[model samples]
Target: MCPVCGQEVESIYHALFKCVGAKNVWELWEECPMVIGTENMDFSNLALKMLECGTPRDMELLIVVAWAIWCSRNLRVFEMVCQGADQVWNHAISMLFDFREAVKFCGLGPLACEVRWKKPQVGVFKINTDGATEVDGRWSSIGVVIRDSRGEVAATLCRVLPGCFSVDETEALAIEARIILVRELDLHQVIVELDSLLVVHQILAKDFNGGLGHIVHGISGFLEGFHS
Candidate 1:
């Protein structure tokens, strides 16, 4: 039964991909392909379809979406917080993007998201980063890890920043650290992957803007070393 609404016994299908509540969760996007005839389909098939048909970026988005949907369901079942699919979707993207930025700081890029889904193979280096802060007698931290193609650990670091800071800044800092580490190792033709679109774009852009000069400068220097 729908514990929140007391209407009917909601199957996993209804709760995850088809219910009114689920629809509300993803309504912000132009549309989700899964909503069409989503009934009577298995979750594995749904994931397969998403992977078989979508671009690399789309595949990454789907991973976050599926994860968010699962998260919402767990929260609803245990905590009674019926998070709408739209909100869950947004949260999924935000979390994934921020995570990407953090991992990329260590010189891992799109491949990090891929390795997350596919698991890292032998001979790849993965770097994980974390940030911490003290709040009202407690410490909280957020961390992300990146692995190279062979799934080896290249870099892992955590910071206790001791104050309030947005996840974005931490992500940017992580990227900076990753790139610096990569330069120190002096590997030629290494693949650097990151999850944040903003950080990726900033790193790839040829010109440096003023506001994030330190980060941009660091990344630019790394690239110069790589090219030289």
Candidate 2:
């Protein structure tokens, strides 16, 4: 039986593909493909399936992220250390980032919403970003959504970083993360729509010497790449 879910027997494919985003949905549903193995396949077949999923870059990231997810599962089952999905995904991304120095290395659902959201202009994508700081002030969780002109969800990300940051800083981090996400998706001609008015002013004014100096500056650099 799976230590995490306890309802299903975990296999190699399950352990590797049931990534962080699907962690929450694991509790009640079998609908998440990432959380539930699509077939009773062995390792060779699993690799073959992954290769057919996305672009070459996506394949690399899948391998790296899968390794990190497997490690998190082991930690939870053996050491009894529990981590939120956001934290797990953030750690996996860091691992992928570091591996590139040694050797070049690297969810689902059209996360929909009921609330009314405005779509962007033709050929452009609008990305909305938000973040929440932990009550103890030790961690921050970020959420982002990207939608094309047609209002179709392009991509979404939620990650947790270990830090004690103010509202603006957390918001800035959220913006920074989408930079990585959009680039990986090869997205340009974008419009960033953030909830933090301060972050908006700072970015528009090109002012980066306040509390969010480091992250804000990096975000500015990333904006230069867009077709907007």
Candidate 3:
């Protein structure tokens, strides 16, 4: 019997593909043809078929998801912990996105602008924020590092958040938390920096009432307290 779920005999197919937990993860990835057409085939056959039928990106995602599921299984067995299907799915997609970004950067010739930290203006404080989630776990964390114009750390905060639906949501949470931290510190003149350009753009736009509308609204409210 499988030590993790105890629902069936331990086998490669059962452990990786057929278990209830694995099925939930596969169902979330229904956009993938391999996931949509899962059959009672052996593990190797299923993997080979995925490679043969999937596009390059699809294949990459498939591999990442499989690896995530395997890692989740191992974590459950050894650490007595389990990750939900949504968490596993989000983790796989995030990994694939990071891999693709890295490949794109490597493909571009040397002129690509390198990112480096710069100090804030003389009277302004800078808050750098970031968020990260675990591939084989459910929770996410947001961190904020506040620095003065002299490039010295003023304050720092780290928080563990519940499982986020996507990286964008996690980033939004980070910015929101940063705003709250600024308010608590009474830092009037401040600048915020984060790696996610999408979140920054969304915040800059005047009318952004999409999925993260509430978070954007919260950020706007907090910004009013800052020195213009």
Candidate 4:
């Protein structure tokens, strides 16, 4: 029904496309490549198509705009949260700039962009410790924490391994992964510590007789000549 007639209810299509209420939104999207003309666009298809196109920066902008549009739409309908076009534009601007700054600081340039990896300065040796609980004779989870000599946290990592494994195996695997990651960053001078004495001893001995033999073998080989 027309506004003059005072319609009782409005459909999403009418509100999003046909209504005067949405005219400004359409115009805004026209300027925003991410959500422009996406009213009737299939969400999945649009996402994939956009992903296929554009550099990393372009994709980042697209993601922020798309998310902002969806947020604005949801705010208007279900939550009864509504804001003017200026507010929405401000929202988009804030999101875009923030994400842009983050990506830049993280040293993640454009997709497939030429990036020279810089080695981190080695201040002190660090070790990331981890644990995995046993449940029902099957492995539950892995918890990892990295710390330097001063007891300052360097990093922490955790994840559930596929299939079942013992706590010792999980700990060993975490230590091995940390060493590889550190080596990739080209920072080799550091001490590795683990609460699990067996894992630490195994690592020192360069022995892979444990359950996670393959992983230990590879890691030991890589760090074999490094000063402990």
For lDDT, the strongest prediction is 3
**For model 1, where is the 10-residue window of minimal lDDT?**
131-140
lDDT of 2 by residue, 38-98 (tens): 4677767665665675456555665655665676677677756565654455454444544
Give the C-alpha miss distance for residue 214 in model 2, angstroms: 1.1
What is the C-alpha lDDT profile of model 3 across 1-228, one tens digit per residue? 987678889887887788888888888875776553357777667777877888777767767888888988887887566768876776676567667777788788676557578998898999999988654446789999999999999999999997634566688899899898888888899999877655676788843565556787888888888884
lDDT of 1 by residue, 1-228 (tens): 764444658766565666666566556545455443345687678767866766667667766766667666666666555554544664666677767767665576555555433434454444455444321223334454556665655555455544333333445566667656665676433445554565566667844653344666776777675532
Q: Pick the candidate with the highest TM-score.
A: 3
- Model 4: CA > 4 A from native: 1-122, 137-139, 148-151
Per-candidate local distance difference test: 0.56, 0.67, 0.77, 0.56
* TM-scores, all models, native as reference: 0.43, 0.49, 0.72, 0.40
Models, CA RMSD each? 11.6, 16.8, 4.5, 18.4
lDDT of 4 by residue, 73-182 (tens): 56555545554554444455554654555566578546646544232335765665675644233444666555555666676667777644445566666777777766
